[model samples]
Target: MSPDQAQAQGRLHDTDPVGIIDIGSNSVRLVVYERLTRSPTVLFNEKVLAGLGRGVGVTNRLADDSVERALAALRRFRFLATQAGAETLYVLATAAAREAENGPDFIREVQKITGAKVEVLSGRDEAERSAYGIISGIWRANGIAGDLGGGSLELVDVRGEEIGDGRTYPLGGLRLQDAAEDSVRKAEKIAADALDGCSLLDGGAGRAFYAIGGTWRSLARLYMFETGYPLKVMHHFAIPAGEALDFCRKVAREDLAGFEHIDVISRSRRALLPYGAAVMEQIIRRAQPTEVVMSALGVREGHLYKLLSKKERARDPLIAASEELAILRSRSPRHAGELADWTGRLFEVLEVEESADERRLRTAACLLADIGWRAHPDYRGEQSLNIIAHAAFIGIDHPGRAYLALANFYRHVGLIEEELSPWIRKLATTRLMERARILGSAFRVAYLISAAMPGVMPKTTVRRRNGELVLELPKDIADLDGERLRKRFSQLGRLMELSADVEIA
Candidate 1:
């Protein structure tokens, strides 16, 4: 059967390690992933700024120093990938390699030294692949995906799995800076002129503009720092077009002072921040995207994503990640799955009309609830809170991040006399906040009844009759019940505005 057919039939097992090396205009990066699951986790990630695109506009060739530095970096990367047990390696060279005069010679040397064939991506290839990465990373995304590198920019209209109308421009940070003679206004005009020719992008108004690249990521970091946005996760961080345009204009002129978290950004990355902002400004103004969302996945991720079968791509990334975490940390993966289904009974008794999204989040919470057992008993809640809140999970936004984190936190610690961090509280709406507390309290009650053991949770039943919420503990485990269980049951009851009653069969 074909890979897609195998995946759809649930016959593919992608446990073998894969490696990708992305050689771009500004930096060379190596990423080793544990497996090619729905939410592939990075086992090792490192990058070096070789500035291969530096002066490429003027020299028509990769810089000599940059080439030497990049070669050295590649040697290290090859060795590291081998040591990491990567079964196969894919080396991708972007704009600098494709546009420079000596690009072929540089590729030959890289092949000889690294023993990996180099694939130079055309502008259209880069744009389309980047759009795929965005699609794989987000649940439902439609807009223009703009990938800014040091040497070139790739723009494409993207909607779900479909990619179309791609175009490449010399509006990359390095290339634009040279073309505009380091003048922001000149750069703006050039960007506008280049963008104007793309009639394909005329309808982007009020839609998303997904920003993908290092310099743009830095800009997002600066924005997060300045705004003091609590959730520091970058994958789905979004800003209104108007607000983003103002910030871009300010950063385009090198006025990035007073951002509290500016120091966290690298000096080399900070230098190109303006060029990134400048290009973004024109795109937002002309394209009129309602919002600018920063995407953490780009070309390398796109390559990996493309290799996945359609069936695998259809799996929910959140569930895949939660299941993996359960296997790695929880007592039994079966118990986690049991907890997930048992919680539905608890919510049903509460008369909560959970939306589809809420149901998904609750299931995720169940899978992840017991993963924090390895941490100190005293701090499992906090540790789980931090890890879930900041995990590299896709298909969930910042608010949902808080919801999962808080749900797991509650699972560890009962809701009474406990509070979430202020930043986390801000991420969840009041309704979601209440739901999290309810889920957490219910989790505590279930944990008490099940003792975190497998096959026990399935016997727990929650029912509401005559306007009273009733929790029934199986007769076999009646001895395990205690005041803590009753109190947690009561807490869950009050959360849903019902009187708590537990029956020990």
Candidate 2:
């Protein structure tokens, strides 16, 4: 059924779907998202590096070849988006589309080929939107955001919802590369000179430098491989200023082709790497940010964020996505809510010191605990793991992602001999890993008693007594006190390193 119709019938899909076209200087791309939330998940994505800005710097016009390629991509994008059941397609044209002399003509052609609404963003407009993307995604970011596109660069100061004035410069990668004639030193000089007037650099000191755009993400990926970083998720990936400066300097000075993990660099993106680095080097020197935190969201997400109400923007993306999944797939949504609160009490009784983030993950796990109930009994754990691992979840980092997957996996199937891969182990800490095991054990006990049906969990009372964890079942629900339930309760106690006692009252 269509997603809208399904939702109306109280059968929600795992995700909401929307589409956007990013028309930039270097490429024109189409991104279809699973939903529009603080954390968006991509359902389908395609990009064509049309080099629309290649000659614009010198000739002040869009190249004929690039124009044709962009238009062709747009035509295909409309059909693909429609077939994907996207409710809206937001076409955002950045620097090149608004800067080049022939930009207007190109936009007209695009509008004709694809009858979707188009937005041509000025540099300031792009900067503000980029800030909104970061603000909406991160918990509470207080930093200077720099988004490097092919045609222009945007810098803005953002803290929560109070966004400072955003400015746009012509120091974008492709534009700077052309102006510097491929000289790394010259590119550095141009970048430094451009930032001389940006007062936002001063406020960024000791704060984060939230890097946006694809080039920064690619750079983060390279850094991840080089360091053997345990978690490879790019969003919220942080690097100290000193380390980032060193990396950028090397990229600016040498060819990445000679470096290790160079294979990660795409051909279309390689030549522009040095230019991106040059921009970074200047931003680092001027801002002296405490760290550089990479953001996967940008102008497109910013546009989406703008459309959201204050209440929707306030909801944690991870929690909202988890709750939505449960409502759609779980037999009883009320049970998920009950499990979350039950686990909270369990944690408090055990005196577990779960940080805010840990608590959030634990609550989400409870909501998603029964996602694989319909799967084959023998493979439900594996099925649930695979689904949650790659699901359209955002906000949670890769390590945290592993924690969620493992917790849900063991929730159904016991922690077997060696189902977890080495990579998964590396994704979380010893503490986080143990929490998963404990949460899984608790889920085991809860399910063995309630069978995941509603009303029974709330009737059960769990409390910590003199050197033991006691579970008191109501006399009315005494039918749940089966041998398997007893065994599972004791197993949970063993996992928690305490004796478990169950009694009917």
lDDT by residue for model 2 (159-257), tens:
988899998899888888889987989999999999977887988898999999877778888888887885656777789899999999988898787
Q: Residue 64 in model 1: shift from native, Å? A: 1.7
Where does candidate 2 stray beyond 4 Å?
1-17, 34-39, 230-232, 328-331, 374-383, 413-419, 494-497
What is the alpha-carbon lDDT of model 1 when measured against the actual structure? 0.85
Q: What is the TM-score of each candidate against the true structure?
A: 0.93, 0.90
lDDT of 1 by residue, 1-505 (tens): 2354345422224576689999999899999887777787887899999999988899898989999999999999999988776768999999999989999999999898778889899998899889888987877788999999999999898887788888899988988888888887898889888888787678798799999999999999989988889988999898999999999998887566655678978887877788788889988888989999989998988898889999988888888888888877788889889988888876775777799888998899889898789899889999999999998898787888888988888777667434667788778888788788888887888778777889887877788877777877788877767787788778777777778788886
lDDT of 2: 0.85
Model 2 TM-score relative to the real fold = 0.90
